[model samples]
Target: MPSDTEQRTRAAVPADAVTEPLTDIIDPDNFTPRLLALLSNALVWRESHELRRRFGLGTNDWRIISSLAIRPGASATEVSDFIGLNKAVISKGVVKLVDRGLVLLVDGPRGSRPMYLTPAGAEMHDAMLPISMRGQEIILADLSADDIDRLNALLRRMLEKTRELHVLENGSDVGADD
Candidate 1:
């Protein structure tokens, strides 16, 4: 006999609740991975379009800028690690930012070049902050504060699990080279 907790959990989702055939993989309605991918892709597409239309910036550009805004004087490698982006991509974005006069690369200790936002960069960050916040607000409008907190905690746990699985499968953590 199943325990009460187990019985309740099983009862929460009836066996017949899933309308699609069990063999149908990649069902967005039933597969969490597919749903998550769809959500991420939609969000990225919308954000990229809006940012490019309003500020002539791409999502990666905004990500780099925002990362710098939070961690000023961070090196390209550090920024790449923090943002989970490819080092080459981050380096290219850094060069573009520097050429646009929005970022400054200063020589740091041990030959590492640290990046900082210029005055114009800070101004642009401030201008773009609202759009970013609004996008978050729109997406999370249905979730309560507690729900949002719990959702973030769950996502963090999933990220940690992903790293662990990567290490187990590949003998190295994800983005270890980056």
Candidate 2:
């Protein structure tokens, strides 16, 4: 089932949508939605990778930091479930974060341990924020202000639909890495 926004933003065959003939022989003139998505993701990942190299942060460490920045006091398992990563990977990141003084692990009821970003972690995330924003700015530089807004609207709808599909496929809001 699609949301109202998703239902409204069908990808119509517009003149502007197809900039050039796709090299792919299949899929009707080689227009692959995935190619666009992957290229966009790769661009973002490059920024993230550079941030990690500069800050000495691993991918999992960065993910955990960003996740905790958004939803503090979440357990490693919860973080894993939230990010669809293996619990072991989350646990490793948490341990490293704790050792680096970027995060703190607190014992909770029923033997559950919750995590929070330390002040240092918060600062690190704040510092790295500009890199992510710059990545977006560079990626969308060709689009005008109005086109940017329209792109955001369409992307948001697509994201919502994908989330719904993820939930339906997994049968839960939390995806299991296993």
Candidate 3:
């Protein structure tokens, strides 16, 4: 009961052949979607470390705070949408920020309410921006200016294509299903 990858490996090489590094066999010239994903995750991890050290924040909390800074006075739902976080997680983040005096909930239209960054939250966000920028600069330093621009464009196209494929296969629209 060989797996698909194992079956392919067996078919490709003789039984007596020595195994080579998977990376070597795989053509690096052919751009893999996985390389884009690995790069994205590495950047995220680097950014998360900076946030943890400077702001004592986790990835979830950093996203919440960053979204609020980008668009001040967003409701829980709005923040959730902006940061691509679940409603429950956003609720918890808001509560935690409120307890720490970093955010405040204000009244909204028709009995609805929204959350806004407090003075403390604004100050923390401003302080964090430079640290986050440094992380970005370090991670992207390996790439030349042209490579950075090309990579950004290619990544955007890949993301869009993935979204389209998901929609085509699942017959469901993105975000609307959730």
Candidate 4:
């Protein structure tokens, strides 16, 4: 016979559970992945609106600048992998940046082509850093220093575990390295 707890759970399940709203299936607050992604996207979009107006830049442009700032001489493939964006998107952005004299694609050894930021691109990256940092500060303002440290530690662990799952499922970065 089923245990008391199992019987209670079975009784609580509806015959037509699909008839219920999605919110009933998974409450927005309780859906960790979706909640985190949506909230992060909303905040980024809000923060980037003014940046777009002032810099004539969209998300891709900022991503390119940010990536090159950290890892100069990164190929489009590397940038795509690092930024969690597709190569096609990174390619398009690289084309734009190169045309604008913001990024340079240098021929590397063994027929490899790597990109690095031009002086103008470095300046642009420096300009955007403050805005990005301010947005982060705004989001983190309510958290205590200890809370921020703890959250960062937890997020790092979660990211590492997620990366492991990705490698296991795909044997590589699914969206990276073509």
lDDT of 4 at 159: 83
Give candidate 2's whole-model lDDT. 0.80
Candidate 2 ranges with C-alpha deviation above 4 Å: 1-30, 81-84, 167-170
Question: How would the candidate models be sorted by lDDT, starting from the highest?
Answer: 1, 4, 2, 3
lDDT tens readout by residue for model 1, 38-89: 8778877888888889988888888899999999999998888888899999
lDDT of each: 0.87, 0.80, 0.77, 0.84
Candidate 4 residue lDDT tens string, 1-178: 9999989988899996664366536776889999889878986896578668878777778888999899989888888888788899998988888998989999998887899999999998988778778778876999999999999999889988887898898898546555
Report the lDDT tens digits of candidate 2 across residue range 103-162: 999999999988999999999889877776786788688999999999999988986787
Quote the lDDT for 75 in model 4.
87
Q: Is candidate 2 or candidate 4 better by lDDT?
A: 4
- Residue 62 shift from truth in candidate 1, angstroms: 0.5
Q: Which parts of model 1 are misplaced by more than 4 Å?
A: 1-24
Best by TM-score: 1
lDDT of 4 at 74: 88
- Ten residues in a row with the worst lDDT in model 3? 169-178
Error of 1 at 92 (Å): 1.1
Give the top-scoring candidate (lDDT). 1
